[model samples]
Target: MGNWKLEVGRMAMYMSFPVVLFHYFNQPTYFEEWVTKTKRNIFPPENPQDKEAIQQLIKDMRTKQIQQFEGE
Candidate 1:
């Protein structure tokens, strides 16, 4: 009975390995979509404050890109 239980546990682990790997491999895309959806739901950019913050973020990003390009 003990051996049977061990065998069953081993089989379960083996069966779950591929599923675990698939989930791990697909985690990044899943997390990205989740974050985007959550952010959109939580902090919409309709207000003036949100719009200014977004614009400032964009300006900072553009500045960094220009600096990098000039350096390269």
Candidate 2:
């Protein structure tokens, strides 16, 4: 648009802007806490009781299936 010097400066700014942003935001210290909090929110901590109940349900289903096979 302007002189050669101005065109080179504009090109440098366009290329360097994303490089600078990527460098800043990609640092672990910049985003680790947010990532951890987001993960916890998406997957709440498991409860011992819930784990036990799931295991018990699976056991009961297995036993029931075994009995059904035996009857057949």
Candidate 3:
């Protein structure tokens, strides 16, 4: 009876370990909120140079898309 109880305890310990590890490893450590906030704050800049840089970036992206569409 003691051995059976010990075996049950060990089995429970083993089963619960994986569950604890799964929760510990799979739990969300989120970053998207702060990253999005940082991105939003950077744009529509007060500096003229920064605004021009953003405009050029958009133009370049549009040009790439147009080239891709023509290629296809």
Candidate 4:
């Protein structure tokens, strides 16, 4: 009877360990929240000139490439 009780206790502990681990692992930890908040605060705001500058640079590069191809 004592061995049976010990076995049951061990089994209960084994089953509960997974539940405890899952509870902790599934929840967001402090470091995760800190990193998320830090990233949100550190991200750069979109600039109005960013798109225009990118488009103009691409156009200029294409034009330069075309000129080089024609020269060749």
Best by lDDT: 2
For candidate 1, lDDT tens digit of each residue in 1-72?
578889999999999999999989787875898889899999875998888999999999999999999999
Q: Give a tens-digit lDDT track for model 2, residues 48-71.
A: 999999999999999999999999
The candidate that wins on TM-score is 2
Q: What TM-score does structure 1 among the candidates reach? A: 0.38
Model 3 gets an lDDT of 0.86
Alpha carbon deviation, residue 37, candidate 2 (Å): 1.1
Model 3: how far residue 2 lies from native, Å: 5.9
Q: After superposition, how far is residue 72 of candidate 4 from its true place, in Å?
A: 3.5
Whole-model Cα lDDT of every candidate shown, in order: 0.91, 0.97, 0.86, 0.88
Question: If ranked by lDDT, best first, what sequence of candidates would result?
Answer: 2, 1, 4, 3
Evaluate residue 13 in candidate 2 and report its C-alpha lDDT on the 0 to 100 scale.
Answer: 100
Worst 10 residues of 4 by lDDT: 25-34
Estimated TM-score for each candidate: 0.38, 0.72, 0.39, 0.57
Count of residue pairs whose backbone atoms collide, per candidate: 0, 0, 0, 0
Model 4, 1-72: lDDT tens digits are 578889999999999999998888777663688778888889866677997899999999999999999999
* Residue 59 C-alpha lDDT in model 2: 100
